[model samples]
Target: MATALQAVEVIRDLRHSFNIGRLQMCRADEWLNALLAERIDSGEKRSLRSSGGRKKLQKH
Candidate 1:
């Protein structure tokens, strides 16, 4: 069995690999779904501001 410290190190490495910088814009919905399902590492909860002409992703 792996030690606790070793497991933590592996998790940290995996989290680094899952950072948003690694994905393409075309996969945003897939990423969002995975994030909602707790399958991805969302570093923080930040709001995305929609431009004046663009429709927002959420329904009010």
Candidate 2:
């Protein structure tokens, strides 16, 4: 029946749109995670440098 075919088409379209939105969200999450990782890495490096300086000063 035409009505059944139309219903199927609508469902297919909705599923396709949902998948696209999901993919976009996944990409955004990846970008945010990468950004956070970079910030954490830099913070660790800064802390290490400061700690090393303190150790040297204490020894002297």
Count of clashing pairs, candidate 1: 0
The sequence of per-residue lDDT tens digits that candidate 2 reaches over residues 1-60 is 222224345655765777757776667556645644554575644543345434423443
TM-score, candidate 1, is 0.30
TM-score of 2: 0.39
Tell me which residue pairs clash in candidate 2: none
Model 2 stretches with alpha carbons more than 4 Å out: 1-20, 44-60
lDDT (Cα atoms) of all candidates against the true structure: 0.40, 0.50
Task: Estimate the TM-score of every prediction.
Answer: 0.30, 0.39
Position 26, candidate 1: lDDT: 28
Candidate achieving the largest lDDT: 2
Per residue, candidate 1 scores C-alpha lDDT tens digits across 1-60 of 443234445655665787635345326546445543442133222222222212222321
Error of 2 at 60 (Å): 38
